[model samples]
Target: MTGMERLSLRVSEMINHPIAQLRRSVTIHKLDTDGDREWEEVMGVLSETDELDMTINDDGTITLKWEMVADEYRQVEADEFEPEEEPVPF
Candidate 1:
């Protein structure tokens, strides 16, 4: 195989690895940009590799670090319904 092709295959294996079942101890280096510059560091256990290390450096940014947990897949509960409003006389 060609050199380029060999390299590509290796990368593909590392990324799309089927045996790459969810492994604990997944670290994430989050970097956010919204309000003032700030950072929140935390660790989490996840399966797929996170791309937190790939953050952009700039002002007005906030970074949150946390591992992806099965809880992340939890469904959000619906809020209680509100009563209909009556129309006011014109």
Candidate 2:
């Protein structure tokens, strides 16, 4: 594989690992009044990975940090949705 391909794959893995870890730690039954605190704790754990920085905002929201990618490397695409048509009366 090319160097760029390998770099892209590694970056993708780095990004995904923390998200997967957070998903594993969370459960509907485990959530309660302390859920926001728990989420912040999870973000703290993820910040240790060094792939991204996490900061808790004054408003209780999280701010994530990562280097900005070049426009050529940006690959975000929004999914297009079509509205469902109503069925005619039989």
Candidate 3:
């Protein structure tokens, strides 16, 4: 399958998964050219569903919010993996 097809499959899975309803929103970051296209294509697919709304941010990120969720959070930079300064305390 093509990269976009694979991404679409994964995105469909995420959206259809049982726990997806629990998430207030999902942020997709364009980390590369393929990823960027994937985000755009996925957004198009989601637009047809009418169950979520997509917002394209100035920082090249796409945010998908569930229809039932309240919009209370402010947009922030796409989350990047960062090493924690302290170890987890158990």
| TM-scores vs. true structure, each candidate | 0.25, 0.32, 0.52
Question: How well is each residue in 1-90 modelled by candidate 2, as lDDT tens digits?
Answer: 754444445434545576644442211111233344554555556568665566666755445555534542343322234456799989
**Residue 35's C-alpha lDDT in candidate 2?**
46
Model 2: which residue pairs collide?
Answer: none
Residue 65 displacement in candidate 2 (angstroms):
1.3
Error of 1 at 74 (Å): 8.3
Question: Model 3 residue 48 lDDT?
Answer: 82
Q: Name the regions of candidate 2 deviating beyond 4 angstroms.
A: 1-37, 68-90
Q: How would you encode candidate 1's per-residue C-alpha lDDT over 14-63 as one tens digit per residue? A: 43444332441122233332112222211221122364332323752323
Candidate 1 residue 17 C-alpha distance from true site, Å = 1.8
Candidate 3 regions off by >4 Å?
A: 13-20, 33-39, 68-90
Q: What does candidate 3's lDDT look like per residue over 1-90, in tens digits?
A: 887877777666666666665675776665454676676777777778676778889998777787552332321222344445797788
Candidate 1 to truth, TM: 0.25
Over 4 Å off, model 1: 24-90
